[model samples]
Target: MWCFDNQKLHMNMAILETQSEGGNIRDSLLLTCQSSSNLIFGIQPKQEPLIRSLSESELRQMPKERFNQNEFSSIKLSKDLKIRKEDIILYNRESGILRDSLEKDELLTKSEKERRKTNREKFKRALRVERLHFLLPKKEKNLKPQPALKIDWSKSKIKTNPDIIKVLKSFYTNRRDPQFPTGNQKLLLEKLAPFPIFSVENNLRQIILAYPPETYMKNLSDKLYDYYYRLYEWESDTRATSIGFFFFNPEDALMYESTIWKYGSLSAAELGTRLSFFRFSTAYKLNRTSPPEIRFLFIPDVKEVGDLVTRYRYQYGKQMKFHPNQKITRDGFADQPIYTIENVQLKQGLFSRREVSYFGELKDHKYIFFTVDGAESAWNKFRQANPNLRLPRRPNLLVYNFNSFINDCEMDPDLINQNFIFMLNREAYKALDKSKQDTPKVSDFSIFIDNRVKPQLFLIKIWAKRLKLVLFHAPRINEFPRREALLDGLTNFFPPSLYRVK
Candidate 1:
């Protein structure tokens, strides 16, 4: 049944091809009907014309050039001439339809051609409108507005710590203290602006809470001391002495003493006694003499002290009165006399040097003057007299004054007496000036003081077994200690309330 149907379909295709190629449409239909009848009747069909398939080479060799009018007429005249089998098949399938359509159009009247062209344009317009309609709803859907995004404020909330809040509140409350100006409070807040306030507050609170009050207070005091210890004003000044006084109880002084020792020298701890003196003075309204008499003797040059009387007269002038010549006292076994200079009145009582002694009573006077060379000579003679008695070698200050000062103060007891304050005059300024020249950008003199002077002062303190005298070196002529510098130094250590001049 399938084979019969297939044969009948092929016969119909042949009839269509024949009609499309200019064969008689009626005759082709009759042939197809007869073939179908034969298939249905079970009669064997007659042999149809054999159509030979052309090779690819033969099909490619066919001429593709357009024909002129004469050539076209010739092609029409030879319409019945048989070409290659493939050519016939190709023309019957596709090219034949196109050729027939062209020939039919040529035969049409002008009015009929115009009518066909208009119909074709109308059909194209309808197809384009249908396509536009199909896409219009999709474009409108795309152009429609989307819903606005809804924000969740809760998700963007700022995180805060309770401890930080507590700390901030404490600072704010303290800011209202009568001691601090509102302007200063604002300035402090501005300084703190760059820091994460909450984070710092939280960390500080945690640290403070972690330690006991005593431990925490001590730690804070230590930190404050370490920060300011190198400043010349703080090294031996009364303000530095007063720092831990208000913060610590009298009973805790020993603890503070031990703690301070761990950080710096014994001299540094002794400086705290200045606070005691301040407390006494404030409470009693009278200066306390509990602090030893600190006498500053400025030696301009160490080499110029061969004859004490002669040098004193030359330096201070004849107007200055000196004590009558007296024999220097010595220990019972010593052959040489101990060096002493007494009662030298400068500028008619401007201020007087009551006595100058080498290895003698250093606490007996408020002022003393002695040359470094003279003191060394006296130390050598005294050492020779008592062979068993040991004395440390004298410090050499000629080459580097400041360095020598530090070394001697740390090593030599004679240099660091409780009652004696040694002031290196022009030599100190020269040394410091030279250092500055070598490195001009050092804005902080505290570094130099710490690295050079403080260690010697500390050594002197240990030798004296008491808070040694405060040493003041002249920075310029007639300006041994700058009062302004001292006050400014106080500002670094004390709260504004305490630093107020009484």
Candidate 2:
């Protein structure tokens, strides 16, 4: 067995020695010491480590060296200094270099040199911007912003409930009847649009959809509030604003995504981003409270939509889902079948904010063969149905032969076998050459399942103006008048408190 002497550990070099056996030396070696206990064979066994808090002055002595060592390629160290192989590995990681500095080191052979370095530079910049924020003068008290006044219908008196009901009918996106509307789509929107919207196309489809049976939310207390992404307050003056909060956990992350718009003091990047820009599974709020501000917002990019009428069919057309990992994505029609949903438990990552997301089994999955037209159509429908529901911005009307996304990626829509996301991954895998390994894994190709949205705090926005609206529509509110009344309450932000969202 080997043992380390009681001599002080050096920043540059440390001596590793075997147990004492007479005066003859068995083996002796010099190794670099690092913060991690990788090179050390043993610690001094007889005495406690003299750990104590450093004084404030001593703590202020920050290291002068910026992280700039590249261990990937061979480099000679100068006489004045020595850096740990871990620091060299970190430098290569930060700069997107793949080779490990200490891969040759016999001692560091067991050390984990591989690390995730995606967007390292971007994160460092974000960190710098945040640190600078602390030095700026603290925000003034009560600098709460007011909600942007899109309408002042509050001034005029409503003559009757039917008048308000008429307005509610216009905003309603969910229509239970399967029959497609008979009139021209544009004409219908022009006649029915309550607010002065910029444009319209096919009115958005509205239908009740079942949540996965394995929902974690079902066990939560009935008093739980449905989460939302709301445009609470629009900024006015930038001089002074309300103090905002930072999120440290999953629960508060839900609060951040729910805060949709920019406000005083808060950067636009901090607020909930638009659905198209969002990388996470847009956690759709079954119990909505926001005023229906948008109509069918056209999703730019993908190809034109044709009618889909096969397996996994919904009200308008069939929908498909693709799993990101743990099994290879497939068309599900071949002899080489993917794992069945019953056997495969879908993991809702912690990033999904478990308190607000659906986990359990990936439910109601059905497949279609690879086709260019169908893939394009499904991609459009999936994005429309899923993403925008979480953070809808401007109303993008119907789709034409839009090709910004698919063309940009140069992906052949026909190769897409599973859902739009899965198809993208499959296409990318095909694009890569099998130079590294005989069997390429998902990580080999530069492909990604969508990353989850981080939780954020929307304290500043919620604290400002009389901008609350209860998105009271849910599967549980079955009766007609009660549903209508809930809609009526959500139709205006400044309206009197009328009904609970539940």
Candidate 3:
């Protein structure tokens, strides 16, 4: 079945090949796998014909030249597009006006003139707005002149100080929260425009990581995985909730903690108390914090089981339907008429189970989750082949203590208390224990899986733990389906080539 659209790249070539000689097709694939040094597998011999058919016999015979031609052509085309040498079409306001005046001398209808005038005004207005946004400062300041009635968008309650709004507005426009926008925060910001959840978690993650580098790294992984797992689970509970689903970045929590650290001089207990009050109160008034729309599943033809092999349908569903149990009805995705296949691979020798999972989606995108199967079960054989192998932990969330981090600063002895050192080690111990499963208590310090922006949060935990940061990320969904796909895809495609020496 060939999935074709007017769009060039949307051409999906599906070739279901049958062997002409019936010479064990599996052996051919196995031969290719061995000869190619495992660079090629998951690809059945049936799929090989598709590639072979695309190549000329001469090209196939001259593998070296063929490879070079493919590489050179691809690189040259991409480079040409990026650095195309062309004469610039310069347009000057004065020259355009002069040309228009000259054209008017030939002929001008009253309606045409009026339409042109209206268009000119509209263009000018748009230009004005663009310039205004461009000139706006990229960094947010704690202090800014505010309207007489200042209100924070997150919490609509009137406040004497309107600095938070100023901060948010800057972040919204610049895509950066200047104060605590570190490396992880920057990555979250980059992804926020495409996936709004990054913005939500940005502040929350910042606070958790501010604890201590060592502790945060240890516990952040599992806690982060648990966060998304819960949200995906929630999507299955009801469509209404799924419809209103949103995401936040983990770094935002860190940003929030940094703000408290920099501006407020209160103890950890006081800071936690103040934050809890502020969060609850603001949530009531402003309805400020909500997840962002990460992806949408618009299934126009889900009525046919066969049509389920489209990538676009899967992409939309992967973003929207977090839990496999959360069934998206055919009627739920009727709005978008045009559809394309987005994820059409297998996992464990079968198409992914209908169980809704964000990790499933990530994996589909990154890895070709395909395995061989036939009359005898392949899973048993594969397991027997690697009996001692164990799957790596999905990912973990780490929480850090802020009080401990500041104490390590070279000047901390003069400015802040060093008691945080002991607190951080204790928290780190609790987070790293594989046997511990207690929900974090709301004491002087608190940590939990950030439901929003779980992958970004998991990555942050990975980075922090590797660096021994004291932050605990709450466990969320194990792996975002898309993320797994991306990681494995890179691994499969980006391998080092081995040369045979004569």
Candidate 4:
């Protein structure tokens, strides 16, 4: 058997070749034989074995440890490692070898990008829905239907109570007399008759003398008491030839005149005869107290009283004295200066003590005064101008030419003292708009008027203090009972005690 050590083969071969020249015939013979075998068989020299290259798929599946670093050093990491279509197109775009593949992958990558974008939008929408679900009230999501509301039409309407109507009718009818029948005589008789034949003339005299002097004399403050006593004493001593009597309602004047003529005496005995007539007729007309109150005036002479009666005309009436002495003044006047703004100037003349009048256009629309007379006049004028003009009521705060108010004031300054003074011009109101809408302070009206009228303003302030004039703003236009509310301020000035005569 031949022994072979492959590791020492090269050294043995070299030794054999070197020993060939120095004979060792067997070694030379062996070398010649190997050379002859190489020639004869056409055998080539042996070289190291070549490594097998892996395909792209095989490299991806190959274990990491099995990979040869030296063999893969020249290959790009992106090509050697598993690469997505998007990465291949992005990184290998410049390689002409991969141009076709990269172009094909471009479509896939675009679709993949769009798919991811769509998924992201869906996620955002879901998040928004979740957030809103947390914010909404649970009850709102399950709301139940509600029943319709109901109102009783009959109850809502202002139907007059039968009981109230019966009471009012009885009240008025009981006071009616048989001798002095009213327009509704049939109704009065049916409701109130089987009664006495009442004498109003005798009743008037009795009512006048019913109260003791103390009723009129007491409760008056020291200043008012002194004033009254002075007038009473003056009248008693001077037998003050004449006295001035002021009547608020024209009907009251008529009643007094008719009663005195019929009964032949100016006593309170006759009050009952015509009291109902006076009350019913003047109930809606006068804003002041009903059953015309009395205010006494003691003048130096009876002639002055006559002058006043004549000057007052419909508002005043006279009667002659049959006896040595008689009371001169009669029922109190309801004609308050404040209520009759237009009559203020004329009413000022009726004040024997002092004359006072406030004259100014209301500023802005802050204060509005609507008069029944003015509204009627405006409606009538409007109807005249356009015969077809229709309105529910007179238009409230109707704008009128300022000249009309100015002319009315100029013609009769007395009328300016009314509760409502129409502003003839917006410009004039703007001019007077400096004062605030509050109670007319002493300084407000006093400083506003001309220097010549300052004393009169002072006197007005003093009178208001004595009378306790309550201040109020008139109700807005369209307010129910606007006129009545405007008149309420003057009501405080006329107490029942002030109206009572001793």
Question: Which one is best on lDDT?
Answer: 1
Model 4: per-residue Cα lDDT over 66-153, one tens digit each: 2133221222333344433322111222234344452343556677666645644443332211110111101112432111111111
Candidate 1, residues 300-400, lDDT tens digits: the string is 23123234334533444443332233222221111111223332222325564332123433445322222434445545665576454343344211211
Candidate 3 residue lDDT tens string, 184-286 = 3333233222211111112223211112111222245434532433322212211111221111212222333334333322222121211111121222112
Q: For model 2, how does the per-residue alpha-carbon lDDT over 54-116 read when each residue is reduced to its tens digit?
A: 222332231111221221222333344344433322121122223333334443434423321
- Per-model C-alpha lDDT, please? 0.28, 0.23, 0.24, 0.26
How many residue pairs in model 2 have overlapping backbones? 11
Q: How many clashes does each candidate structure show, in the order listed? A: 2, 11, 116, 36
Ranking by TM-score: 2, 3, 4, 1
Highest TM-score model number: 2
RMSD of each: 48.1, 29.5, 29.0, 53.9
TM-score of 4: 0.15
The model with the greater TM-score, 1 or 2, is 2
Off by over 4 Å in 1: 1-302, 307-367, 370-419, 440-502
